[model samples]
Target: MKYISTRGKAPALNFEDVLLTGLASDGGLYVPETLPTFSAAEIGAMAAMDYPSLAQKIITPFVDGCIPDSDLAAIIADTYAEFRHSAVAPLVQLDHNQWVLELFHGPTLAFKDFALQLLGRLLDYVLERRQQKVVIMGATSGDTGSAAIEGCKRCSNIDIFILHPHQRVSEVQRRQMTTVVGDNIHNLAIEGNFDDCQAMVKASFANRAFLPEDRGLVAVNSINWARIMAQIVYYFYAAVALGAPARKTAFSVPTGNFGDIFAGYLAHNMGLPVERLVIATNRNDVLHRVLTTSSMRRQPLQHTLSPSMDITVSSNFERLLFDLYDRDGAAIADLLARFDEGEIAFSETAMARARSLFSSACVDDEQTCAQIAATWENCEYLLDPHSAIGVRAAMTAGIAADIPVVTLATAHPAKFPDAVKGAGLNEEVGLPLHLRDLFERPERCSVLPNDLAAVQSFMASNIRA
Candidate 1:
């Protein structure tokens, strides 16, 4: 399959090129030239396959020309083998129709593991074949850093660097990233918010003169097509498990970067019979504002119990905008250019089209806590703050009673214990046995200012010599 940039200027590329060249040359995200669709019979047939087998079937079309089938299947099989749960992405029913799709069972205890683990294997395979090295730079509010680092730490060909907002992420989140000892892994605690870290990563992609000429820069964030492609699998897994195509399923996704929900959008396009895609956010709700009021404006990032969703700018929204504009890359480029200057209103036609299949809700900290408390009291489910926001959105989304509403549980409650305690529950959530001694682990990381040059200089000096 061929991938094209959201902006009109970049040359179209195949899967391998898009996998390596994240954030296209023209400052745009790459999307499939044309999406692959599945028939209802095909979607229903997947109900009998295990997670790894189903993953191989779903992702084969996208990577057909790039990786051999046997190689891709092995990579996928080994990826899920790292997850703590045998079910991989399991479903827990809260009520007759309300459900939670448990996605934090992977190594990092966050939904990101579903993608990053696969991405690491893919990178290792591709780089091994070409006998080349690359640099991985990513920004995280909480979960992505640890997951990315864990995924790529074993690779000998890549130097991975992750930046997170200093003192903003939870103790578990920070420790998860900082405690891993590897010559190839570097963590940065930037003295700014998540958006600042994200902007620096984007800027580095735009200008990489500071890096060695022979090395390429890669993205572990959802901007990479590989990450998004990996994410699309769970949506299908959850849907088919609950009977999709033959039955409609709704999803409530707690997203900051817009990548997770955008994958749901792709699943619906791929004929999964998705009833509704709810955009769940905390106080930093640019996505809700854009969907509800047609206003796309930047706001100050807020510190919330759900640190992961405390992002004012949602990056992957541009991919949806590209689709909303009927794949007109020039129009998307112009729209984004104006948006960067200031607020720009979304077109009424596009908003109308979005409203048909999508809905949104903004849950503040109080509501997040309340949801956590209520779910625990009623169903004995301990939800992390991010997952609390998702459950709240799904409960109040006003969908019909027959349709199943699955809230994507983005993180394990143990990752954010303070937030879990803040919900008025005296229960203490403990880390998994593998991370039982996380607090005692010696952490190694650098504290850097939110300046691109400082970060680049640090990366240049710290890379394996």
Candidate 2:
């Protein structure tokens, strides 16, 4: 399957190239040239399959010409074998039709593990075959850093660097990334917010003159097509388990970068009977504003209890906009260029198309805490602040009572003990057994000023020769 850039200028690429060459040459995200759709029988058949089997079925098409089926299957199996849960992405029912798809059971305890784990393995296979060495530079608000570090730490041919806003992420989140011990793994605590760190990563990808000529820069963030491709599996997994094909399933995703929900959008187009897609956000809600106001504008990034969603710019939204504008790369480039100036509004047709499939809600910290408290009281289910935002949004989504709505539990509640305590819950939220000693682990990280040159210099100096 060939992938094309959202902005029209970049050359069409196959899956492997898209995986490696994230953030297109023309500053766009890559999307499949044509999505592989499953027939009703095909989707229905997935009900009997296990998580890995369903993953192979859904992901095979994306990596068709790049990785052999056997190798892909092995990689997938090995990747998921590390997850703490047998179901991988399990669903827990809260009310009659309200469910939370638990996605934090992986090594790093976040939904990102679904993709990053597979991505690290894919990179290992591809780079080993080609005898190439690359560098990974990623910025995270909270979870992606630890997940990416965990995923890519073992890659022999790659050196991974992750940046997170200093003092913005939770203690668990910070420790999760910093505590991992590897010569190839480096974490940077930037002095600014998430947007600043993300900007540095994007700018560095756009121009890599600082890196060694032989080492290409790779993206671990959702901009990579492989990340999004890997994520599409759980949507099918959750939907099929909840009775899809004959019954439509709806999803409410707590997203900052828009990557996770974008995967759901891809699933809908790939023949999943999705009832509605809800965009659940915390205070830094660029996506929420877009769907509600039709204007995509930058705002000051806010630090809330749900630190993972503290983002001003939703990078993956451009992929959806590319489709909304009929895959007109030139138009997408122009719109984003205008967006760089200050703000940009979509055409009425584009807005109408987006609104047709998406409804959004922006929840503040108070509501996030309330949802956490309410869910604990109602069903004895503990929710992280990000998942709390999702559950609250799903509750208010006003979908029919009969149709099931599953909130994607993006992270384990143990990752944010501060949020749990803030919810007025006296019970301690202990870390998983794997991370029980997280606070006791000795962390190694560099505190860097929010400067691209400083980051690039550090990366260049630290890369293994």
Error of 1 at 451 (Å): 1.2
Model 2 pairs in collision = 8-329
Q: Relative to the true structure, how large is the alpha-carbon lDDT of every model?
A: 0.94, 0.93
Clash total of candidate 2: 1
- Please provide, for model 2 over 333-376, each residue's C-alpha lDDT reduced to its tens digit, 9 standing for 90 to 100: 99999999998988999999998989999999999999999999
What lDDT score is found at residue 404 in candidate 1? Answer: 95
Give each model a TM-score. Answer: 0.99, 0.99
Give lDDT tens digits, candidate 1, residues 15-52. Answer: 89888999999999999998899999999999998999
Candidate 1 clashes between residue pairs 3 or more apart in a chain or in different chains = none
Worst 10 residues of 2 by lDDT: 427-436
Runs of candidate 2 exceeding 4 Å displacement: none
For candidate 1, what's the RMSD?
Answer: 0.7
